[model samples]
Target: MIKKLLLTFSFLAVSMLLAQKNNDQQTVDEASEKLRLAMISGDKTVLESLILPELTYGHSGGHIDDAKEFVEKLVSKKSNFLTIENTNQSIQIVDKTAIVRNHLFAQTHDFGKEQGEVSLDILYVWQKTKNGWKLLARQAVKAEKKK
Candidate 1:
């Protein structure tokens, strides 16, 4: 009888751990989707909520922008995203940080009316903080177009 109870307790403990991990994964996934929508809509409030103050955002073209510069460009119509579509994505969490890999296709209208597009591979690092998950850094590499 004691052996059965021990086994049951062990199973319950494992089940609880799995549930918690799954819940955390769901939270990060939802946050990522919100980020995509916010970028497409140029929503500063949502963007501020998602990105850390010390964010390092790098572009495929070799430019790197700190949080203030990045946000300012987005808010001022210097950077305008018309669409953001993810071709594939994966997120892995370790302790308080999550690493994300995404293959993305995007369209933009920048500098008021200059149009642009990109297919890129992006790596994002997210840190879990008191306010929730905030993007700490991102690096993007433009992919070669398929014929």
Candidate 2:
């Protein structure tokens, strides 16, 4: 009887742990979707809310965008992304952090100068925060056209 009780308790504990893990993953997914929507809508405030205070952005062309520069560009209306679409999204969670990878297609006019349909491979690093999950880093790789 005692052994059976022990086994049952152990199973319950493991089940609880798995449930918590699933919940964390769901939260991260929701946060990532919100970030995508914010990017598509050009809502700087929503974008800011999703990102960590000290965010690092790496561009495919070896350019880097820090949190301040990224936000400033949005506020100044120097960058615009429209008709954004995401595909092949996958997320992996490790302890208190998550990594999300996806393919992005968007029509963007940056600085009112460069306008085109951009295809990107995006990597987002999210950390579990006291408030919730916040993005710590984002790296974008421009997809090369297949000739």
Candidate 3:
């Protein structure tokens, strides 16, 4: 009887852990989708909504920008892209923060008429804040480019 109870408790504990992990995964997914849409649409407001006030972005342009600068550039019509693809995304949660790693494929228009596909390795750090999951920092590096 005691053995059976122990086994049941263990099973329940494992089940609960799995459920929490899945829930956390979903949260990250939603945030990522929001980010992708914001980038493609050049909607800095949406992107800023997900970002923490302390946000920092290390762009592929060999420069870094703070939350304000990042939003301004995105909304200024200076950078235009037709598509943004998030591929092979993985998230790791540690306490109140999560790190999402993924690759992005992008195709841009005009702006020197640059048309090609580029692969970028990206890292997004999110913090669980009073509001909700907020993007703390995002850093991306160019892995490859095909012209």
Candidate 4:
């Protein structure tokens, strides 16, 4: 009887842990989608809420921006995103941090320039804070062309 009780408790504990991980994954995915929409919308409030104060945003062109600069560019339409599509996304959570990778295809018009399309592979780092998950850092590289 005691052995059965111990086995049941162990199983329950493992199940609970798995459930928590799944919940975290779903939350992170939602946060990521919100960020994508915010980028396209250029909503200052939403962008500010999703980004940490000390963000490090890297572009495929090798440029980098801090949180303030990033937000300013979008708000000012200096980096206007007409449309953003994310594909093949994967998220991994390690403790309080989550790592996300995705392929980004976007139509953009920057600094009132002509529209262009970009294909990039992006890496985003998010931290789980008191205000839920906020973007910590991001880096992007040009996607390799398929033959």
Candidate 5:
């Protein structure tokens, strides 16, 4: 009887741990979707809420954008995402941090100046904070056109 009780408690504990991981993954996934929509909508408020104060946003073309610059570019019409699409998105949670990867395809007009259709492989690091999950940094590399 004691052995049976021990087995049941162990099963329940393992189940609880798996559930927590699933919940964390769900939260990160929701944040990622919100960010995608915010980019297309140019919602500065939502964008600011999602990112950390010390964000480092890197572009595929070797350019980098700090937190303030990242938001301003979108809010001020210097950068516009006409459409955004993502594929093969994945999230891996590790303690208080999560790593997310996705393929991004977008039609953009950056600085109101270039052709701006790009495909990129992006990596985002998110940290669990008192205010919830906040994006800490992002780096993107240009992806070759898929045949």
Candidate 6:
């Protein structure tokens, strides 16, 4: 009888852990979607809310931008995103941090430049704060074309 109870408790504990992981994954997914929309919309308020004060945004061309510069570029339409699509996304949660990887394809219309399309593989690090998940860092590399 004791053996059966121990097995039952172990099973319940494992089930509960899986449930919580799923919930966290869903929440992170929603946050990612919100970020995608905000980027395309260029809404400064939403962008500010999602990004941390110490963000490190790395571009494919090897330029890096701090949180303020990143926000300012987007808000000023200097890095305007007309459309963004994220694919093959996977998020791994470790403690309070989430590591996300995905393929990003976007149509951009920067100020004083012609519209262009970009394809890149992006890595994003997000931290769970009291206010929710905020972006801590991001890096992008140009995506390789399939042969």
Task: Using TM-score, give the best candidate's number.
Answer: 4
lDDT of 5 by residue, 5-106 (tens): 999999999999999999999999999999999988878999999999999999888899999999998888688888889899999999989999999998
Estimate the lDDT of model 2.
Answer: 0.84
- After superposing candidate 2, which stretches have Cα over 4 Å from the reference? 144-147
RMSD, candidate 3, Å: 2.5
Instruction: Assess the local accuracy of residue 7 in candidate 5 as a C-alpha lDDT between 0 and 100.
Output: 100
Q: Could you list the CA RMSD of all candidates, in the order they appear?
A: 1.7, 1.9, 2.5, 1.5, 1.5, 1.7
Instruction: Write down the TM-score for model 5.
Output: 0.92
lDDT of each: 0.88, 0.84, 0.82, 0.93, 0.91, 0.93
lDDT (Cα, tens digit) per residue for candidate 3, span 44-136? 779778998799888877798888887776677456667888888999988779899998988866355557566799999998877768889
Worst 10 residues of 4 by lDDT: 138-147
Clashes of each: 0, 0, 0, 0, 0, 0
Q: Please, what are the lDDT tens digits per residue for candidate 4 over residues 41-125? A: 8899999999999999999999999999999999898999999989999999999999999999999999869998889999999
lDDT of 2 by residue, 1-147 (tens): 999999999999999989988999899989988877776676878888888878998878888889877777766657677667778888888999999999888787777586877788999999999989999999999885322
Return the clash pairs for model 1, or none: none
List the candidates' TM-scores in order.
0.90, 0.90, 0.83, 0.94, 0.92, 0.93
By lDDT: ranked, best first: 4, 6, 5, 1, 2, 3
lDDT of 2 at 32: 83
TM-score quality measure for candidate 1: 0.90
> What clash count does candidate 3 reach?
0
The local distance difference test score of model 5 is: 0.91
